[model samples]
Structure formats: structure tokens, C-alpha cells
Target: MGKVTLITGASRGIGYALALEMHMRGHHVIALARSEDKLQALKAECNDNRMECAVVDLGQPAQVDQFISALVDRGYTISHMINNAGALVNKPFGEISASELRHVYEVNVFSVFELIQKAMSVFADDIHVVNISSMGGFQGAQKFPGLSAYSSSKAAVASLTECLQEEFGEKGWSFNVLCLGAVQTEMLAEAFPGFKAPVNPSEMSTFIADFTEGAQKFIRGKVLPISSTTP
Candidate 1:
């Protein structure tokens, strides 16, 4: 059997492109996202049975755990786990609400932690775990005015990746964080309406696919910042 890759937020943007790229490389992709319609569209685009999808709200940890359990019961061993699902609440720091902050953390930080914990049980030997973060959250990256909640949540993700690497790297698991720069995607557009991102989602996805597929073996537990411009 081909290696199984689990990708969250796979219905669109970088996640969707990564799913396609990985599928083309002959891997079995399990794509999860909140939009059923988009997920179906992605599956249809695959034009093969190699891609599976689930419409899931990653903010709900219990539901995510149940889904992982089902995968385990089905005798699936995941070789790659991509925590690509994230939420952004781009508001001024002063205007951010408690609920908004909670939601962002729930989706970006807590859900990632939960998924990684559950996935650890079924990870194949030498598995790679990629947690998507942002350049804004990365140290010394250009800061934006309205991204406090989202950026902080991503920062937590980076920290978590580092900690998990220390705990799990000795056991053949590679944990890495990709602190991505602005990409031309819905999320980026929503956050910065008039700004044009230097790179496209497909371009970023290709780089990410290469890393997760094998290139990542050269380094473990590293936070990589990728952008067209130096930060």
C-alpha cells in the first residue's frame, strides 16, 4: 500500500494544493476540511480513488479524536500528518473579543495539539509531521497590525512543534513547523485585501510536498521560514 497522508484544511488553498501534489506522487491522501462542497470538489478533481475527504470542524477536539479513532480501527497507519487547518481573526488588538481569541486558539493551537496527540498512535516509522504556521508569528518576521490573535496562535503552534520534536524525535518521528509568508490564497486576501502576495499557493505547496516527501530528513525539529522576501 502507498503511504497514507492526513491533511487538515485540505479543501482549499495550500492544503488543497498539497493534497493534489501529494496524491500525484502516488500517496493516499485523507483530506479534511469544513466545507463539504469544496471537499467533494477536491475529490472529484483527483479523478482517482487515491484521495479521501472528510468534512470536519477542526475546532472540535472530541470529534477530531473520534475521527482519528475510526481511522485507526480501519487499520490505517499515517505516514504524514499535516496540521494545515487554521482560523484567522484579523482585528485590531484592542477590538479583539474573548470569544474571537478563543476560537482562533481552538482552531490553530488546540486542534493541532489534539490531532498530533491522536496521530502519534498510528504514525508509521520515520513519519513526518508538518504544522503550518505564519511568517508573522515567526521571530523577526514583519508584523502586521491586525493579526494579534491569529499570529499568536501560530506562534504557539511553532513552540508546540519544537517541544514535540524534543519528546518524539528520538522515536523516528520528525516534527517541523513551516512558517509561511503571504501566499495568494483566500486567507491571505481576507487578511490583507489590497496586498498582493509574492507567491501562489501551488508554488508553496510544491515546496512543502518536497520537504514532507523526503527532503525533511536532513533536519529535524526545525522551524523553517519560507517567503519570497527576506524577513
Candidate 2:
């Protein structure tokens, strides 16, 4: 079988750009997101048989399970898996509701756990799992206000990546987390309006694509901070 790459949140921002980059690099790319129209737009842009679009809401555990099951039924083995989908709530800690907290964790943390667990059956021997986190989740990194739910969930994701690496590194599977800083993406705009980030989604996606493809050989169970500015 050929190499297949699965990218979540591929409807927009870094996820979108990363999907395109992987497709261009000749990987059978599976672009997944909740928006069907946006996924269609990505499919239209790709216009290639190598790219497959799936509308999946990562927050829904059942949807995530079905997605992995479909991939297995189709005999597709994932070579690279990018957990790039995230949920952000710009509310102060006290004001953050339980539902809001659950939503954030569902997308940023729980869904990642479920997806990776289910995808194991369809994973290639040399699979590389790249979990996208935030600089706010990085230890000693600057923290921001009104992001208690989002940031804490991201931190959980980073920690999970480390544990997974420790458990699976002996199997030769690579797991890493990239704690990114501000990037000119819709999420950043929502979190900090009118703030122009130094790096754009496309540039960041390029770097992520390179790192996902080559960094696994040199790094595993590592949490690398990818930032040039304070967000």
C-alpha cells in the first residue's frame, strides 16, 4: 500500500495548508474537518485523486470512531497522523461554563486520545503522530488571560503525547508535540482580534510538513516549542 497521511481540521488555517502540502508531496492525503463546504473547497483546489476529504466533527467521539473504522474497512494504513484540530474559548476562568470546558477538552484532548487509540489498527509500522499544541501549553511559556479552558486542554494534549511516546517508542512508532506560538490563522484572530501574527498559516504549515516527514527519525516523545514571539 502507498503512504497515507491523515490531517484533522483540514478545512482551514494551518490544517488546510498542511493538507495541500502533503498532497503535493504525493502522499494519499485524508483531509478531515466538520465543514463539508470547506472540505469541498479544499477538494476542488486539490483536484487530485490522491486527496480524500472527510467531514468529521472531532468533538464527536462516535464520529471519530466511524472515521477510523471506515479507513480500516478500506484497507488504508496511515503513515502520518496530524492532530491539528483545536477548540478555543476566550472566556475568563470563572465565567467559563462546564459545557464550554467539555467542548474544549473534547476537541483538543479527548478526541485526540480516541482517534489515536482507534487509528492504531490501521497505522503503518513507521507511523509518525504529530500533535499540534500551543505555546501556552509549553512549560515556562507566557500565558494569556481568557484562555483557561483552551490552554489547559492543550497542556493535557502535550502531556499525552509524551506518555504515548514512552509507551510506544519501543515499537518504533514516533510521537511528538509541536507547541506553536501565534500564527495568522482564524483561531488566532478569534482569540486575539486585530493582532497580526508574525507567521502565516502557509509558512507554519510548510514547517510542520517538513518536521512531520523528517523530524521523526531524530526526535520522539519530544515537545518542541515552535515560536518566535510571545502570544
lDDT leader: 2
lDDT (tens digit, per residue) of candidate 1 on 3-41: 999999998899999999999999999999999999999
TM-score of each: 0.97, 0.98
Q: What is the C-alpha lDDT of each candidate?
A: 0.89, 0.93
RMSD of each: 1.2, 0.8
TM-score of 2: 0.98
Off by over 4 Å in 2: none
RMSD of 2: 0.8
Candidate with best TM-score: 2
- TM-score: model 1 vs. ground truth: 0.97
- Candidate 2 lDDT score relative to the true structure: 0.93
lDDT of 2 by residue, 53-87 (tens): 99998777788888888997899999999999998
Clashes of each: 0, 0
